[model samples]
Target: MLLRLGSLLFALPALILLVLYGVEMSAVSDCTQLGGIYNFDTAECGTEAIPQTSYYLRHSGLVNGMMLLSVLGALAMSIGMLIKGMAQQAKS
Candidate 1:
């Protein structure tokens, strides 16, 4: 019961986060879309570029870190549950 409940808590949240991350990743915007210019030291693309960067690129490290941690946590819990089951089976 404990294993099932704990796995549900971890696995469900991890799955939800993974889906959300995928959705967020799909809606990505690139600087090139604004113009060929990355930044406007002078007139660029006939206007100031403002050197804008995508939200995902700016915070990708944090996002990836969170995703990695969640995945690892879910995997760890799942493996632990499996190991416990195997032990129980061996006992029987």
Candidate 2:
């Protein structure tokens, strides 16, 4: 029982991050639809933009970081859960 809870605790953060990143991706896609570019300084979309490629580039970095963390959490949860199951089976 404790192991189950521990595994779930490790997994919960990954689920939360996945949802947050999904929303962020949606917002970026919406911004791209306006036929304008996003300004990292103003955090808004505009025409005749100043080529703020850094906005997307920095965000991509953040997304990549988040993805990496989430994957680690998932792997931890998988291993923890697997160990818990085996321990229980051994006891039975």
Candidate 3:
């Protein structure tokens, strides 16, 4: 029960984050398709390119780090649960 709860805790956040990330990516793609620059910090699409790099691109390390951590955390917890079940089966 504890393992299941732990897995849900990690998995839920990761799932929500992945959906949000996908939405952001889609917006960026739409902006690019329309020949506009999308500013992550400002959350604006503009015809004139900004001198500063994109908020998302500039802070890519941080963003990617978060996504990686959350996803990996969920995966690790799930794998642990699976292993525990397999071990129990093996014992029987």
Best by TM-score: 3
For model 1, residues 1-92, the per-residue Cα lDDT tens digits are 54555566556655765686565444332434654444423323433446555545665776666666666667767777888989999999
Lowest lDDT block of 10, candidate 1 = 38-47
TM-score sort, best first: 3, 2, 1
Candidate 3, residues 15-63: lDDT per residue as tens digits? 7667777887899899999999987777778887767565467667766
List TM-scores for all candidates, in order.
0.42, 0.49, 0.55
Candidate 2 global lDDT: 0.65
Task: Report the alpha-carbon TM-score of model 3 versus the true structure.
Answer: 0.55
Note the Cα lDDT for every prediction shown: 0.59, 0.65, 0.74
User: Which regions of candidate 1 fall more than 4 Å away from where they truly are?
Assistant: 1-54
Which residue pairs show collisions in model 1? none
Q: Which stretches of candidate 2 lie over 4 Å from their true place?
A: 1-41, 45-56
The TM-score that candidate 1 achieves is 0.42
* Regions more than 4 Å wrong, model 3: 51-92
